[model samples]
Target: MGAKDGRKGDPEGFGPIEDQFQAIFDDFFRRPVAGSGRDRRIPMLVSLEEAASGASKVIKATFEAHCTDCKGSGVLLGGPPVFACSVCGGKRHVLQERTLTVKVPAGIDDGQVLRLAGQGDEAPLGGGQRGDLMIEVIVAPHPRLRRAGVDLFVEVRIDAETARRGGRVNVPVLDGERRIVVPAGTVSGAEMRLAGFGAVRLGAEAVPIPAEVTAAPYRSRSVGDHRGDQIVTFVVGESSTDGQDDTSEGRRAARNQGLWRTGVLAVALVAAVIGAFVLGR
Candidate 1:
């Protein structure tokens, strides 16, 4: 009887039902499954030496996880639903803090991010898959050194006599101090290269040491067979004096010239006074 009414018998009449099924399938696939949390990004600060040599560091991070009290449903299931979950307050998740030990790769630059799989937030009532955690690295500035890509630059102050005579001088290195030869007639801002002293290149086979071993210096293989160079720039004079002529003779000459200028100024002031008195008379 329904076929006779042209409702069930027509193929076009089934279009609305097929469309409804298609819509249902699409919605089911598009919705995120429970327990799949969002990814998070956090910052990690490291020293220049630490960045050059890979090390494991412990860091604290906060993220969200499904509430264990309500099982992520946001309500109590044992009784008739009357109010939200007391633990999560209907949010389905709670903030959780955890300490994680992360490996910082050698030669890692500032603003670079390292991803840890499944370390992000836990899914809220979704599936068991957690999101990834991204750690953005921040390299601290060194007191006497500046970094450019894989190269490191340092300014070493040398006296005028040493700059002219050319001799060995102590310069700072990543581990400690080292002596480098300076050629005769070397001027200020002259740069000398120390090969294999700079940072390790990224993607090198660098192995990280344990956190406990960080206090004691350990070299990582991440430097591979070759490393970047450290460029030493020679600055003449004492750094504390702001690039002034620091030689003893130079200081004595400067004082004598200052005294001569003071005497001349005094003499000019006395002559002006005598001329004024004469004009008044």
Candidate 2:
């Protein structure tokens, strides 16, 4: 899929999920398959089915949904009549904010959830503890870099000068300062990769940007050895300095990506390549 330019507004990340786990009545066995790999402790995703006559599995899915408005007291913030809940006495909650930072363990895939205890609504009658709050994590898309598990994809633009002569370039990556080598005649939209620059893995390798080949429009796939190349798109420009300075943040980032220089190099490269072919033949 084509990536939307990152130079635009920074896409707002989906906020955290801070409520109860919505139950799926049927049985859910979050356990490993009978025989798959050496990892026995690894959990499996078993679908739940409603049982008929008899069954050995059962689940008690209980949770307290927080009060939507006055934040758990079921009262308007203005004054008296629309006032205090007689039970908790306007204190709002019978439980404290669940303070367990809740470890977001690695290997946990996207949309995975982490639960924190006592983070929901308290009993209206008082005395009992609160409900649990679940946080769901989702991976956000990167404008320039594409993520594949623990790997990252970064796209770099090379000008006719950098492509034909080859040089060092500063590229945008998950962890910045990724110095990349622009090969001679590198062409436009060519990608230079930094190995082990991907997301964090569990233990053995916390995070690694894998070395594999890349593809996609202004995108990177595995950085490797194959028919993969950095795709280049060309744009013709009217050469003149009569335009105002690109003061906006987005324009500046585009310029840093060498888009301005790329336009010039594209025209120049075509002329040079044609001249060489004709002269050589």
Candidate 3:
């Protein structure tokens, strides 16, 4: 019956039924705005060496993409005009996994994020621009090297003989190994600095430096022109007995020696006071 006839048996008119179907179809097949895409986070692990020298890392991520079956229209074809897509529950997107390689800049600190434009989820309806992928860098700890800003600190082991007599110690730098000269009577825990051998300065471009200032030790230079220094701390290792480690024993001995010197100084001060009192009497 026509909608205008208003038959008694007809519950709702054809126009209202069509309008209701259209509303349901519109809700099921809604399209997102252009240039809108899902944002994603990717955790990237990097070694100290990789952070020192820039590297490219690959990461795998899963995101929503426009459905291929429905062609982002959320409607089925080849038969009756189905308002909603049965495969995607009327949603126009499907889950997809992808892997991408990201270039990590040199001198990137831990917890820093790198943004990759248009690498995230694909835009809905296959028309708008894709979203961005954020890469979070996690720098792994080195066995010997500790990072502090752009500076690197490392502890080198030396035998008792080398600690007493002058010797050359091999220190690991970012690029290669550097041999450091140890003066005679060098004590344990002594630190030596090697200029331009540390972490690269991030965000600093290359710039010219003065020759005289470059020669000066402990001069802090800008990011691009100069690099930080590598600080090497000497650790004196004692010979072990019965194939047992002696590091703890050596540290205890060093502490005892300090206490003994302190106790002797205290005794000397007390004796000096007693002597002066007696002389004044």
Best by lDDT: 1
Model 1 per-residue lDDT tens digits across residues 172-219: 777776656666688999888766677777767553322222211234
What is candidate 2's lDDT per residue for 9-33, written digit by digit as tens?
5346421110011111110122122
lDDT of 1: 0.70
Order candidates by lDDT, high to low: 1, 3, 2
Q: Give the TM-score of candidate 2.
A: 0.38
* Per-residue lDDT of candidate 3, residues 1-281 (tens digit): 12322334455546433443454467444434554676778789999867765678887788868777777665665647555555554455677898787887877889999998888877766767788888899999987788998788988877776677555656666655655565557677988776666666775532222222232145554533556667878777874111223333444456788999999999999999999999999
For model 3, the superposed segments whose C-alpha errors exceed 4 Å read: 1-35, 73-91, 205-224, 239-281
How much is 169 displaced in model 3, in angstroms? 1.8
lDDT of all predictions, in order shown?
A: 0.70, 0.37, 0.66
Which should have the higher TM-score, number 2 or number 3?
A: 3
TM per candidate: 0.65, 0.38, 0.63
Q: In candidate 3, which residue pairs clash?
A: 204-224, 205-224
Candidates ranked by TM-score = 1, 3, 2
- Among these predictions, the greatest TM-score belongs to 1
Lowest summed lDDT over 10 consecutive residues: which window, candidate 2? 18-27
